[model samples]
Every structure is written in structure tokens, then in C-alpha cells.
Target: MKHIRMILINGPKRVGKTTNANLVADMIGRSLPDGCRAHRINMADRLKTLTNSIYNVRTPDGQIAPPDYLEAIKDQPLEIFGGASFRQALIYVSEVVIKPRHGKTVFGKWFLDTVNQVCKPGDVVITADTGFASEIVPIINQVGGDNALLVRIHGMDASFDGDSRSYVHWKHVLTFKDDTNAPFRIGDASVRPDVLARGGFREIDVTNELGFPERSAQAVLDYAARANWLVRPTEVDLELAKGPTL
Candidate 1:
């Protein structure tokens, strides 16, 4: 059977996990042979789709808006839902309703199903929004440990100051809590150090210091070098090739 590489990006809120995923996808797409490209998928996509359906709302083009758009208008009260903001509604449906009914691995199962259907041989599938271990363990198991890469992004400037997202408090939730000592802590949440300890899976740590573009580019370069893929010369290389500026 043809194999695909799966990159799972894990990090706190607003730390550019999605940015890195997209950058890695683009980089892989350029390096891979013709007819094979990278694909970006979010673990929360199923949640967003369910949220949109429950609210009976669709984008202007008759499609559901992604979670980021919902987050942008998260505080806007929904009249039909008794003034609950989009964020509140999503939390209710996901945590309170779905998990209680369908189990915690429901989203994970859906994600795996999607990956099985859509991902082909030689494709690099990257996901930026991997929060809980429950959501990704099955993926690692399915894709086999050797084919998966877990990238943990650390944003030096990131803070939990005013953020009230459910994920921020996940470490405290009984079902999601990890008993093992975490390697790092982001706000109140542990950064899934347990998941990182799994054998046979390659792990990468990216410190987001030079902002998204530079850091993401650096990440892709690192990944390419590690994966033995053809490394494309970056802008820095081009500048260096011309010698130092006076």
C-alpha cells in the first residue's frame, strides 16, 4: 500500500499552528512529484460543520464558514439560540452535547474517516488544531507511528490574559486531564507532552519568535531536511548567494 506522511501541529490558541501547517503543506507540495500534493485538514472541522448546521446558518456561497470566522464573530449573540455567542454555542454542542452522547473520540473517528477517504499515496496531510490526545492517538495508530510527525509550536509572546476558549481550560477538565508530567505548560493547559512521548513518531519543536512567515518557513525547511525531501533554496539562501550587504 502507498504511504502518506501525517503532520500534526499542536499548540495553544493564536500561536500560528494553522499558519505553520499551511506553510508546511505548500513546501511539501512544491517538493513532491507531479500529481501528488500536501493537504491541510483541521481536527475541529467536524465540530464547525455541526455547529453551522445546528445554527441553521451558511456562508453567502451556501457553505459553512470555518472555525476562524466563527471565532471572529464569536461574541455576536445568536437570537435563535437565546443570545448565546457563536463560541458559546459551539462549546455547548461539542462538549456538553456531543461528547456526552457520542463519546470523546467521535471527532477523532470522523477525522480518520476523512483522511482515509481523501489522502492518497505520497500526500502529506497536516492538521493544525490538535488539542486533545483523544483526538489524535487513533490517527497515530492508524497512520502507523513511523509515518506521523508531531510538531509542537511554542509562541514566546503568547499569553492567556483574556482568552476564555474552552481549550485553554482543557487541562482542568477531568476527561482531558493528563496525569503524566508535562514538558511544558501553556497558560493552564499542558502541552500534550504525553502524546509527544510515544515511540516511533518523529517530533519537532518550533519556537515562534520571528513571527509566522519566517518561523513557518524555517519549520518547513527543517522538516524537508529531516524527511530527505529536495530542499528548495529560501529567500535567505538567495540573499546569502549574492554575498553580504554593505
Candidate 2:
């Protein structure tokens, strides 16, 4: 239970998640106390190296199993290699077979370890958000409990549903909406609206309110700062935002 003030900037793709994250980090560094540090957990950079290995049994014709085709040759048998040989191969693949892991090489526990290092007692940690907001909520709990706070900057998109989208959604979600009795659950964990409000967590509907064009990162950050979060800029940051020097 270290006291950490964490802000999770989440939303759909092209929603300015990164821009807001960076701005928030910069603001925290300037606005907070002298010793406070504003750090960004760039998940994309870290997770781009994830291992995505597949155990494929190339057929005699050179046609491999379709990627992500997970119909096990169990229960009712199908064609192809068939019988005992297929069963043995499947067992070997399941047990001793080693395949390349796709996506980020390190996940779950490893991610938490990295985050813990970036965080301090009074620092503001802005997670470089991914589409996996719901899925990673548990990881946040594991890393920062009463000490950390989660804020999701929402974007309007019909395709942002957890199931349909590539960004896998988890059952346990702690959401911030204008809902009464809306206790969002993350895995087995849950957070109520009142709790979030008390903990300095709130939501902003950027799609309608903010006149953000498609995929503009900077616009998203501006919207968040104006609406809910305050991003205090440093001299360097302000210069960067204004554009590079000649």
C-alpha cells in the first residue's frame, strides 16, 4: 500500500491516448511537489516485443494450420492426420512443444515489475494506454491499490466494444460513467462510481464535446486537460508543443 497517484489514460485507438498520457506526465512533473516525478509507461514500445509463437504441424502439402485456429482434435475426431498419431502430436505440442509467443515478450508479472520501478510515493504515473484497458485493470490493482488512482479518458467509437475489438476486454471492469449503482468490476475486483469520484477519478466523453479530428493525439490531450485533468507544461514541453526550433 504505497501511496501512488496513478492515472490510466485509456480509450479506443486514434483517441489521443498517447498524447494525453505524455501531457499528463509533463503536467504532473511541473504541478506536483519538487520531488515528484512524472513518468510514462510506454506499453506499445515495451509490448511490441511480445512473443507470438505458434505450434504448427505443416501438412504434406505445405498448408499450415490457420493462425489462431484453435479447434483441438479432441472429443470428436476430424479428418487430416487422424487417429493415434494426431493425438500424440497434439499431446506433444500441448506439453513439451515450445512455440514463439506473440505480442509483448513480457506480460502480467513482468509488466507490473517495470511499473513498480517507475512509481514513487508521491509521483504521478501516466500509463501509456493500450486498448487492453479492461484486461489490465487487475494488473493495476496488483501494482497500486489504495495508493494508485485509475482514470480512463473515453473516446466515442462504435467499434470500441471489448468483444469485437482486437483489444480484449475483461469481465472485471471499473468504469467511470454517469451511472447510478454502476459498480465496475475488474476480474474479481470492483470499484463504484462514488469510490472513483472520491478517489479523484472521473470520465470525459471526448467524441461529442471535444472537436477532435480522427487520430489526433495532441487534440485528445488538450481535451482531457481542459475538461478534467490539468496538464501544467514545462518550458521544454511548451517549446515541444509549439514545434521544434530551427
Candidate 3:
């Protein structure tokens, strides 16, 4: 079998990336290669959860906790005075945590080391979050090395009647042609470049169910089996041959 390592599950919030990834991971029995793992990049929420767990506890030193107790609890400490809880959990093979560091930090060598340490040969590292906003492709390029696969899941509801009485924003619904190169706006600024750079393999039409649940999950599995990312050369190779774009 081809060494299929690294899979990215990208999508809008609450669109079932996590749920689907879990289902798929279970379905394939041996879906995950040895040393391979799955994770959710909810750094803020995760940090809060971790902080809350050991938040107000008095240290063994019999003194009050330190000021940076929160930072000391992350899965991986990106900074000097980082946490150790996350680092400990990540020592195992099946641990899901959030991704810290934005921008170049996302592709930093330390970040790669953490992943490489947890990930082994034939491993499939998965990220089920809105990480598609920035360096999606470059991140994938960096992670997958040469034989990795990247898949993005899109959660959309297309049943807008454009009624003035509708509760949801009917005008924001995507149209037929709008699927291609649609502008993703975040607040006043446009985060389109980040999303587009990572791009998507196949856009799942989740309009009917509005929550891919199992279909989207199965689609990702099936797509990985036959997706171009699995066969395409390394991201650097593609960039060298096609020109540096993302």
C-alpha cells in the first residue's frame, strides 16, 4: 500500500469535521497507521479547559500557582515558559489537542518536530478545524512531505428562500458559480487568500443535511483513497514545477 500520511479535515465551524473524522477513524478499523493520530486545533478552548483543570491548584511547593499556569498546560509549548501538560499528553500515540502558533509558527521546525515525534511511518495526521484560512496548502505541504493527502470539508446550507422573514442571512448563501473562487470574508477584512491558498480537494455539497455527519466523513475517506494529493509530488515539487504560488 502507498504510504498515506497526513490528512487535513478543513471546514466551517460545527460542520462535522470532528464527528466525521472520528467515525471514519473507527470505520477503517486500521484506518490510522501506527504512530498516526488525529487532533482538533481548538487552542483557545483547549487551553481554557486545561487551565481550568489545574487552574487554582496549589503547587507541590506549598505556594500559590504561578502567573503563567495557563501557558504551562498546553500540549506543546511554543514559547520558552510554556506548559507541560500538553507535552505529556502528546507523548502518547492517540492524543488530540489544539494547534498553537499562527503564521510562520504554524510551519516552524519545532511544530514539525512535535508532529514528527507523535507521527510515525504511514501515519495519517488529521486536523479538523478552520485551519484552511491560512497556509492550508503550505501547512499540508510541510506536513505530508511527499506522500500525504489533504482534504477540506465544507459545511453549507443552500436552502435559502431569500424571504425577508427568514432568520438566517439568505443573501450570504452561495450560488452555483459562487462555489469557484468564492470570497471568504471575516469581519471587515477578507481572509480569502489564506483559505484559497490551502484550497480544497472536493467540496462536499452538504446543503440537504447541512451536516455531512457520515456522508462527509465517508467522502473524506474515499477521497483520500483516490485523491490527487495522495499521488501528487511533494508540495515543494509542485511549487518548483508550477511556480511558487501558495
lDDT of each: 0.61, 0.43, 0.37
- Pick the lDDT winner: 1
By lDDT, the candidates rank as 1, 2, 3
- Per-residue CA lDDT of model 2 for 143-216, tens digit only, reads 33344434444554534532222433322245512122223311323344444444433333344224432223
TM-score of 2: 0.47
Candidate 1, 1-246: lDDT as tens digits: 127777777776667666667666666666666777778888888887788787776777887665565666666787856888876777689777676655555566678778888878877788887766656545654555557776777765664344333231222222353232334311222223444354455666778764334555467556755666443524334222222211
What lDDT tens digits, residue by residue, belong to model 3 across residues 1-246? 124344545444434555655554444323443444443332123333343344343457765444234433443443432454433333221122223212221322233444555545555555443232232334333433334344445445422132111111111111101112213211212223433354433333321135225555555556665654233212122112222111
Cα RMSDs, all models: 8.4, 12.1, 15.1
Task: Give lDDT: candidate 2, residue 182.
Answer: 21
Judged by whole-model lDDT over C-alpha atoms, candidate 1 comes out at 0.61
Q: Candidates 1 and 2: which is better by lDDT? A: 1
The deviation in Å at residue 123 for candidate 3 is 1.4
Work out the TM-score per prediction. Answer: 0.70, 0.47, 0.42
Clash count for each candidate, listed in order shown = 0, 15, 4
Residue 168 C-alpha lDDT in model 2: 32
Ranking by TM-score: 1, 2, 3
Instruction: Choose the strongest candidate by TM-score.
Output: 1
Badly placed stretches (over 4 Å) of model 1 are 60-71, 75-81, 159-198, 210-212, 229-246
